[model samples]
Target: MTICRLEVSNPAFTPDNTQFVTVHSSHLNRRHDVSIYNVNAQTENVPIIVLMHGVYGNHWVWMGLGGIHHVYERLRSEHKISEFVLVMPSDGGLRDGSAYLPTKGHGNYEQWIMDDVITAVQKTVENVTINSPLYLSGLSMGGYGALRLGAKYAEQVSGISAHSSITDLLELTEFVDHSLDAYDCRNLHESNIVYWMNKNKNKLPPIRFDCGREDILYSGNIRFVEELKSNGIPHIYETFEGEHSWEYWHTHIVQTFEFFSDIQTHRR
Candidate 1:
């Protein structure tokens, strides 16, 4: 990963247990910010969860809107989950969204997440290292990114969890105002979630996803689950009672935290 320059915020100036990092990435040829939450900075060998946001959202969405830091703190205090460093990153600053895919003219948003984001976290967080377990997660378009990228880079990820995901690239049209041509890539398969999951099926890490029963993407998620079943891919899928609102994600994200914590405990 080629980072032209790096900048980290002063912890004292930021909210408790949270900091921001800015990386000038060669992949995107622009500076992007990442919001990090480390409840206990002195703890080492903890897992890192990279939370990608959906369309029209930036790095602060997870904490600012979802209150993920508060969720993490509550989960830890209640002894329901293990320690983790939360990393929230922007989606390459494309029009409405980047879909976290590499485009011919739009720069490699995929590489920005798979490479630059990880590198930034390793550098800026003292508790995070190259060897620490990494988890991928997100909401809506971000959910698609987590599922696709986690499958494509299975060897590097420990687990994946997505909420109300867009199963295919075409689904982006329903949410964004930009034309599909903006996401054009040499290999169409690169934009497909099932393609990567099938290609790396054998090496895939633990996978799970959920959708609100009333979400517009609910039908797509059901079809996706069926495809996974027919292909014999191992995953966990569930439906909740809510819509595609922040309230739904805020309440359900606890499931993902618990899932990751269970995986970590088993690994130990």
Candidate 2:
């Protein structure tokens, strides 16, 4: 795969992560602007961690704590995490934040992820190939995207880390009784998972999740963990001291990166 970096100048953009870029994908055939950081090229295929944001959020959330560049550079030279590229793409415009869902008469938010976004990563980054495999991780809206896409296309993603993520939309709709606004996209039902599993249940990827005890989204994460456990699914579910804020996500993302690297080693 061939990759190239792009300069982003979108009026709707937000400042979240350390260093950001836009990658144009040729495999899935789509144009995507992705924010990437902490990249290190090696002779073999490098492991990548796709960082996603919640509703009404942009790539800048990763940089909200003001340490993305420092962390990225440190990981590259000291921690050897330089082989991992942090990617944050435009899932969709903020007004249409449907938890990365497909809205009617609006935009195909899921496509923004399922489409050539992966191809764009393959092209823009060196050694990060597509149609091969990847480690998926996300927060909130991104958490939903990571699980949905990972389940739907088990052939692509090898593992998933969904932090404070809502898995079952049908269950999520129990709380959201409003229209399918950008916010409405946050609720996910269990039926959605079943549908994807039915299509590829024979080969579902591994998943892990965590949520704060005080978070409003805590119940959703717990319920998801319960269901997965009841069905004999092995997943990592724990309660951490945090809320639905970047401070929590920022701290958690680092650990998630290590988890992703371990999975990649297992795959190798």
Candidate 3:
């Protein structure tokens, strides 16, 4: 049995309702951090949105750099969205990025997000429970994680959204200096986004992805969307007018929140 332990800390820089948690994951045999924004602690049955970060980013990037907390507040205040607990988790501290795939030597970064992170949130947050609806969203490499993992574990996730995503394992070469061999796993399908989506197409939750027109990854995202259409996989894809930067993610993250809100409304 793998025993995972957690320690909670309040980072001084975090906004009023955010809590930073460090988990000693047996899967990775190292400590990873997760930043949670839980304004709906007193509210029951609030959905949990797990946001993953891309290359060169940590757990706080979503809130500290992207100001997602501010966006959530505005959406909730205006009743444009349902109450949600935001969870931002680090990508297992690999090189420039982990690709969120399980590697032979580096341990299972995939489980670190899918299992340990969710378990920690349930244990720490008062209102988040096993019953809370689970949503996944991310950007760039993180977007790959959200799309792949959400499809692989369709039964556990309610919806998925991504922006400026790396659609294949080879795409990591564009951003990272390391060799792609570091991310190789026995099951090749684990590293391919379209494979998992097609394998679990019947069970996949509502998925949405977008790419900026000028971003380096725009062509790859276009190819991915075309493949999805050819395979009859269900998803939402959009093209925006920005490049791959925090400016783009921060401006368009509202669409992700609103997309999840729409899912929640329809579920009820």
Candidate 4:
């Protein structure tokens, strides 16, 4: 795992505004590059939030839309959370259509995130204390990753927030008419939500999910909620009138932050 402290150059913003130190690693378990957003706050022990980006989205995806600056500034300034840090790494270049899945040639992405990437982040933050709790959230493809990780390790995270998550992979596959032969046996039982949920039935984490009503992925989102209800899984689900655009994603991300923040406070 490679982690560094370097500033990104974005001419659009002022020197200071663009001066963000990024920590990224590329060679952990052959997983996707692990990139994190260090707010440069003045605290040794900060709460850490592992956020992921949607398909084809980079770490900068949430920078402009999700009031990202506000999210960072608010948490840091208000001391609204525990030792706080935001870790956002893309699912490789799989931002657009990869679905955060591991095809035949691809390596084990789920294990990479669950193990290497997470270990790298924890190790990089040298001052992390036992009190530090990890929080996670994501949008679209990222949304799927965030919850999957949390559900996979319910004992580790405080909570999870998902924006426009394609929760029901079985339905999503049919809706998109995509092929999953590379990952599964050409059946939903292998990698879709229908299977993912069953695998995590006894240990699913607290969930918050939302989507735009006009978005084509609305069906998949609603179906996820239905499955949760049928299985008596506790979660928060809602819908807003909009399309599959940055506008909707940006609006919901802030809400996601609020939800995560509240979880920390209540749990503590």
> Which ranges in model 3 have alpha carbons more than 4 Å from their true place?
1-3, 10-14
Which residue pairs collide, candidate 3?
Answer: none
Q: Which tens-of-lDDT digit does each residue in 72-184 have in candidate 1?
A: 88998999998899999999999899999887686889899989999988887888889899999999999999999999999999999999999988888999887788775
Q: Compared with the true structure, what per-residue lDDT tens digits does model 4 show for residues 93-185? A: 531445555556554455545555566566655545455677778877778777766776677777888888867544345334446554533
Tens-digit per-residue lDDT, 42-124, candidate 3: 76877899999999999999988999888888988998988899999999999999988888788899998988999899888
Prediction 1 TM-score vs. true: 0.97
> Which segments of candidate 1 are over 4 A away from where they belong?
none
TM-score for each prediction? Answer: 0.97, 0.77, 0.96, 0.77
Q: Give the least accurate 10-residue stretch of model 4, judged by summed lDDT.
A: 19-28
The models' CA-based lDDT, in order, is 0.90, 0.63, 0.90, 0.63
- Among the numbered candidates, top TM-score falls to 1
Enumerate residue pairs that collide in model 1.
none
Q: Write the per-residue lDDT of candidate 2 for residues 67-137, one digit (tens) a residue.
A: 55556656556765535666776665535355666665555556567654566666656667754457777
Judged by lDDT against the true structure, how good is candidate 3?
0.90
